[model samples]
Target: MHELSIVMNIIDIATEQVQQAHARKVDSIELEIGTMAGVEMDALDFSWSAAVRNTVLSDAERVVDRVPAIARCGNCGLEFRVSEPFMPCPACDNVLVEYLQGKELRVKSLVVS
Candidate 1:
């Protein structure tokens, strides 16, 4: 799965950050992963376990903040939560909308020590 690559990339970033800070290892990591980011949590967890072996993040506490998808109606200017990308606006039945959030996939914070 692509989650493996994603986890590997995160490890690489953590490694670089630890080196830059001259820290021994990462104590914890906080991630912001939106629902619409298309990452399966189980797959990500599995990938993380394998990718972080002998790395700076090997023993780091991992925290993921799941962001719910939100969209703004183009026709009615109404903002609402959405479970999927193509969801019609609840107020105006508008299919066309702009995503306000829930596409994020990033490392939010790292606690190094």
Candidate 2:
């Protein structure tokens, strides 16, 4: 699965950050995952454990924060949260909605010591 590659990349980045910061070890890695980011959280978690097996971040805990998909309707100016893609405006049934959040996957923070 692509999740393996994704986790591998994450581990690589975390390792680099840990080295750069000259930390003894990485305690936690926080990730912000949007609802529409198309990433499977469970798979990512499983892959993370496997990916970090032999790395310096082997003991690092992966924390995922779910970010809701928020969009504003162009026709009605209504804002709402969505769980999936192709979300039409509920109020005006408008297909044109500007997305304010979601579709994002990023490492938000790292706790090192």
TM-score for all models, in order of appearance: 0.95, 0.90
56, model 1: CA deviation in Å?
0.3
Which ten residues in a row are the worst by lDDT in model 1? 83-92
Instruction: Give each model's whole-structure lDDT.
Output: 0.94, 0.85
What's model 2's TM-score? 0.90
User: Per-residue lDDT tens digits of candidate 2, residues 20-79?
Assistant: 999877899899888888898888878877778878679987788889999999999999
**Model 1, span 1-113: residue lDDT tens:** 99999999999999999999999899999999999899999999999998899999999999999999998999999999996667999987989999999989999999999
Which pairs in model 1 have colliding backbones? none
In candidate 2, what residue range of length 10 has the lowest lDDT sum?
48-57
| Cα misplacement distance, residue 7 of candidate 2 (Å) | 0.9
